[model samples]
Target: GCLPISIIGLLVETTHLSLVTPVGWWLLVYSTVVQFCIAYVSWFAALARLPASVAAIGTMAVPVIGVVASAIALGEPLGAGQIAALVFTLAAVVLATR
Candidate 1:
């Protein structure tokens, strides 16, 4: 999929280029590979032990983790409504798992 888009973009002379140092590009690629490898391993491990229904529901935590991680790491704000929603989601997940 990425190869087709890349080929078309190059053929159309509309390919956008970024200015990153060689080291930076290498680091970016390395980190992407490492992160994906870790994610797949974690996913497979979870599926090995968790029931399908529970694993399906477990995916709901991903957004919650993203919200919290962004607030902490990126200094993003969490409003009252967001906090309430997070609480409700966590409560539902916990209740459903039980």
Candidate 2:
């Protein structure tokens, strides 16, 4: 799903490759291997083992986690709308599991 967009982004940003420091390159490689490769494989393996409903609820929780993580790690603001959305998402996940 993301391959095409990633390819395009890589092509577009190729000229700026010189801007990346050695540490930045290492971080990118680490993120690619850990986030894209290991995380996806682990997620799929767990999904295969879990019941459908549980897996679905777990999938739904991903965005909620992302929102909270961003708020804490990136100093991103979580206003009323985001809080409400998170509440609604949790409610839906609860309802779905039952």
Best by lDDT: 2
Deviating ranges (above 4 Å) for candidate 2 = 10-14
Quote model 1's TM-score: 0.68
Deviation in angstroms for 80 in model 2? 0.9
What is the Cα-based TM-score of model 2?
0.82
**Candidate 2 weakest ten by summed lDDT:** 9-18
Cα error, candidate 2, residue 33 (Å): 1.4
Supply the global lDDT for candidate 2: 0.89
Candidate 2 per-residue lDDT over residues 1-98, each given as its tens digit: 89999899888775677889999999999998877897788778878899777777768899999999999999999999999999999998898888
RMSD of each: 3.5, 2.0
Candidate 2 local lDDT, residue 84: 100
Each model's lDDT comes to: 0.85, 0.89
